[model samples]
Target: MSIQEARAATEQYLPGLIAELKHQGLMQLEHAEPAQLCQLFRRSNAAGLLIPQQYGGLGASPRDTINVLRAVGSLCPSLAVMMTMHHHTIATIVQLGGIIPAAEDLLRSIANNQLLLASAFAEGKPGSPIFNSSLKASAVDGGFVLRGTKKPCTMSHDMDVIVAGVACTDTGGVDHQGFAVIFAEGANITREPFWKTPILRATDSNALIFNDVFVPDEMVLLAEGANAEEIEASAQEASISGLCWFQLMVGASYLGAASALVELLVCKRGVQDTHLAQLAIELEGAHQALLGTAGTLEQRQEADAGLYSQALCSRFSVQAAIERASNLAVELLGGMSFIESEQVSYLLAASRAIGFHPISRTAAAPTLADFLRNTGSTVDAPEPAHV
Candidate 1:
């Protein structure tokens, strides 16, 4: 099917899936049960919107994934995020060219609603300033051993597969160089509940401790070393979709939250709160901007296909979308916005959590800027065009 057709099909199935979550009372629950979001992930996987068909996924277009996620977030932000994390994991694996041969089986299981995955990065302690990973992995015997903790790992405890990011050490100066995307189960993993936010509590963002976990070579996705400039360059090029996909998902969440906020406002349309009215306008602006960016992403020129321009656009677009969602959420809800029951409060928190999600702005900006500077036409005095 065409990308547009795939998108439409996924959008068609989204509302019912969201309604199911709401019916299950998943919408009102606290943020500590990341596992509960499984229903939402299962539904998305059933739709097969995020994964490629060759790998047992529906292989829907990126636009399709964004639309479904937006609808899901409107009802339960936590569920939406869980779905995002799952796709992020699967997409990363796919982009890296079957990091594990079992990747196909895993995708099939995801499609069958038997497996779930989460991004296992972000530890409490600092290690790699870019990824902010504090976890340490030591190599031994036939496989590698991992020791360290990750904080705010979405659905870490409940995930069937935890994609842990670990730094490989070598004799050459602490290496911090080669990175491993280790695929392991949550069976032996210890989960310490750490999510303190009022929103996205269902994400169960907990601390994950790996005590000498053995990841076989097959389970290890050997990406270029983080410290090796050439390896990093290759990874950046290889993980294009992995890097940009989150932008679409983040925008979806913001748009979903904005929609919810507006719906709430519509209930009190004539309530004479000018501030709310203005907030509504701001939300509208954000919505339009998000849609515009989506269009830009979809319409990227073939000539520029290999360039990092799309990723650049996605990086900035995600940050701006999160900012807009937060701004309007605070304005429209006012003092009560902090209340968990408030319509936009959960969404606000989700946006905040995602704002600080993987690939922080500080880390993403310079890489994006370099791409734009290299590709963009020089604005230097317009080359004194012949008048």
Candidate 2:
């Protein structure tokens, strides 16, 4: 389907979102943190976009989800990036919902109340693995007490729930990696200024300090492993599913940002036909890659290392297209356009932020190489520490 059609479908799920965002204007949306945009999202019941219908949600399909993200990215790239964190968290919770009754209840509450969720997976350290969180947890009487911090936690200010990866030490002294669902209510969570960068500042990605935060047993989901190295098969599968969804949606969002620039070119008629065609081909190719990967995952109705590898490959490809398209669009738009307005420059900077996301090209190279060499290899394996 066309981008227009995709946007129209997005409107069906998030009514009046695009209109309201436009009303807020591009400069305001891009320059400041997205508290108001997030509120608008909550009002539009966007929290239920991925929740199953049975759980009082929209149960939007993967294709529709990608479309909606792309539409949002075109308007405000930060919101789109933050929403990927939210949606991916939802996907993970839903995948594990069968075994966790509390998580299912949480989903219903999220759908009914339009509560926003934030993810704290990456710790913002160089060469650190994505899943290897520094947030520490110690076993306590009814639950566990969390300590440490999650830097660059997207949706930090407005999130009602924060799902964080924790390095937990159990009563038996077994150390493992797991997720902790910390509710905002009565929790000891605090925010600190962390995201100092001007690029994508609207995401509100700051440091969330869990100061002796108490998480009950019901709010924790742990993988079956004697140590971090031996994560259970089921947990690994769920993680693969969540990560695949993350890559697809995140890639589409940046594509939309690049498309915004290309659309401006088309509207102004400033570029030659051949140049326009080149931009279209790159952007459309990236779009189809995302859609095709989403479709494959949907049809399979399951996630594995192979599909996850494909998703990573598609995401990197999309990243390359975004960079190329943004560069070309800015150059073709001319210096006058650059000096006159922030639209071209802002989008260029924002679209390139996709490369900064987890599983960077450098990190995934060896894993991808392994996958390419052996078709039966698992892409869900832990990344090398040096990445």
Candidate 3:
């Protein structure tokens, strides 16, 4: 099907999936095991959303993938994230070209419900140079020996493949040719899960350790000094367009969670005061802005080529959605919102965790600074009316 048709079909499937999730008690905001999450993906129809038709995926566009993720997120952000990372792995493999020895087979497995892949992009802490990434691979006679510990790898437990980056440690520092992107089968890897967080407990975003893993020459998606600029250019395009879709999904899920909280409010306490109503309107505006951005990105219209603007807008949406959703949930649900059983609490955790995901927050400074410098002046701002 065409991209547009695929996206529409995805949209049509969401409400039913949401209802099913609620019915199955998956929406109870509970922790799920890695195996269980993987099974959930297959059962929820999420596993086939992004793989190419030739390889077993739905062959959907980035837009369609985002829609599927948004639907999943609306029901369960943990599931949403797990699925997002899975598709991202596929997208990465496709981006690097499927010529790698087992790459095609991996994608086909995903298409055939035989494999799952997670992204191991973020390492160490959020922004530290050391934490940035120290993974390295050296050129060997027959193949490359990969070594490094990648932290915060999504879906590390059940994933069958990992698309990770390694910085070259040669005398030459962080040059374009100073990096290598490698794909490793999950069997050769080890992981330690991070479960202290309340949100996305099932995401299994954990640390991955690679000990002298041998990847055949054919398995190297990207090699040292191999047109580094070209790969980065592709990644930039993917980030501004493809990856942006995931961010949009994040916003949509936040909006849906808040919508559910609002429903619970209506059932419990009747109509809310005018202020809460106004807040609802504001939240709705943010949601509309998010969807509008998604539509614009999907079209790939030249007018939407403003990468800087799009990125900043996405950041603002995430922050605004998190704040609005949190405030509204607390205001509407009152003290009970803090309880784990409450939907608001789970939604709150999801929003917060997503807001801080390494990939999403890397632009905090630049995005905030750009938005701040481009805004209206204080002299022209409207004053608040007396309470």
In candidate 1 the C-alpha lDDT for residue 215 amounts to 74
Residue-pair clashes per candidate, as listed? 7, 0, 2
Better structure of 2 and 3 per TM-score: 2
lDDT of 2 by residue, 1-387 (tens): 256766897889988888877788777888765787687778878899999999999999888898899888888888888789899899988987865558899999999999999988876665555677878988789878999988889878888998888887766877777888889877888889888878888788888888999999888767643643444555677788998999998899899899888888888864698998899888888888998999998898789988999999999999999989899988999999998978888888888888788877777888799889897563577777994
Could you give the C-alpha RMSD of every candidate to the true structure, in order shown?
5.2, 5.8, 6.0
Predicted candidate 1 versus true structure: per-residue lDDT over 12-80, tens digit per residue: 754366446556653455443555566556644542456677766677565566666666666667777
Judged by whole-model lDDT over C-alpha atoms, candidate 1 comes out at 0.59
Model 3: per-residue Cα lDDT at residue 347: 69
In what order do the candidates fall by TM-score, top score first?
Answer: 2, 3, 1
Residue 346, candidate 1: alpha-carbon lDDT: 55
Candidate 3 deviant stretches above 4 angstroms: 1-16, 26-29, 61-64, 98-106, 128-132, 170-186, 223-232, 239-242, 273-276, 301-305, 336-342, 359-362, 367-387
Each model's C-alpha lDDT? Answer: 0.59, 0.84, 0.58
TM-score to true structure, per model:
0.77, 0.93, 0.77
For lDDT, the strongest prediction is 2
Q: Sorted on lDDT, highest at the top, how do the candidates line up? A: 2, 1, 3
